[model samples]
Target: MSVYQGRFEGRCAIVTGGASGLGKAAAARIVAEGGKVVLWDLNADALAAAKAETGATDVVALDVSDQAAVAAAAKASEAALGKVDILICSAGITGATAPVHEYPLDSWKRVVDINLNGLFYCCREVVPLLLANGYGRIVNVASVAGKEGNPNASAYSATKAGVIGLTKSLGKELAEKGVIANALTPATFESPILAQLPKSQVDYMRSKIPMGRLGEISESAAMVCFMASEECSFTTASTFDTSGGRTTF
Candidate 1:
């Protein structure tokens, strides 16, 4: 038997960026614990692969940055798995690394659109559903960079910081309504996103972690699963750090 042991039995969860990496890990764990999950991602092929890997039939190919698409995906998830009990906003991007003054406007916009704006759109659409059902857990995947801004990655850092702020605000707003919002900050997790980073950038990230190693995806997923579970009811609007001692704040 799993340690979670039906902790989320019969619950419905939607994991954005579920096509790969930490998102997929979370989805698999949720399903293993008896919760139904909808995997939402922009890559249809990756979504299909994740569905197979996790045995999740409810997969939606939609861009999280599009408000209409997020709303539609929310509706589709409800239809497929009933009301959402847990929402994990894991979709994000590691934008080009450049000094703030040299960063392209488009790159910054794209990062903000998907990382911060898209997360809000998902929350906006899902919170009501949770409120109607009288229960929900939302875990936004942020990063340590959001807390301690990283050099040459202003856009990524700023967007994640926005997510932290949004989570705090929403957590307070829904404190008495049975819906909780929280954010997770994982540092230098071993994932596909790291592959896109330049060698110098990657080394910088790795060196910043006091642990001298990158965090495991499963370690981060464990924190996410705990936050999403009914057992984590008392905490809200707080940021949980699983950054291998990289985050002292």
Candidate 2:
């Protein structure tokens, strides 16, 4: 029997980027705990694979950056999951690592579009559904890079910073309601997302961690499960540190 077998007995969650990485980890944990999940991703094959692996209730192949697509998916998610009691916004990309002036304009925009704007769109469309239900948990996956800016990753850092800001504002706005919003700042973890960065940049991040090693996927998923639970009642707008002593703030 699962340790969290009954923690989410009747809950349903929407996990963006659910095909892999932190998102997939979170989805797996939720399902293990008895919650239903809807996997959302841009890759149809990944979505199918994730659905098969996790027994997710549904899958939506979507680009969260596209407002219309996000809106449509939100409706579909509601239909599939019945009600989205939890939302884990784990869809993001580490764009090209470059200094501010050296960063490509297109790449910078793309990073902002996916990491920041996509999150905004997902929240924008889903928050109302959550509010109508009168209860919701929102876990936005940020990075330690946002808190302590990395040397050559301007766009990624900026977008994650935006996520933190957005979470704080959303939490305050919904404090009186039954909805809660928060962000998670995690250090480099062993996941597919790590392959997007250069080895030099990856090594640089690992060196910065006081733990002397990269984070594990389970560590992140554990924190996400807690934040997505009713146990996280008093922590809206707060930032959870999963950064292995890398985040001091």
The digit string of per-residue lDDT tens for model 2 on 116-165 reads 99999999999999999999999999999899999899999999999999
lDDT of each: 0.93, 0.93
Q: How close is candidate 1 to the true structure, as a TM-score?
A: 0.98
The Cα RMSD in angstroms, rounded to one decimal, for candidate 2 relative to the true structure is: 1.1
Clashes found in each candidate (C-alpha, N, C closer than 3 A)? 0, 0
Report the Cα lDDT for candidate 1: 0.93
For candidate 1, give the lDDT of residue 61.
Answer: 96
- Cα lDDT tens digits, model 1, 28-139, are 9999988899999999999998999997859999999999999999999999996788899999998998999999999999999999999999999999889988999999
- TM-score for each candidate, following the candidate numbering: 0.98, 0.98
User: Which residue runs of candidate 2 sit more than 4 Å off their true CA positions?
Assistant: none
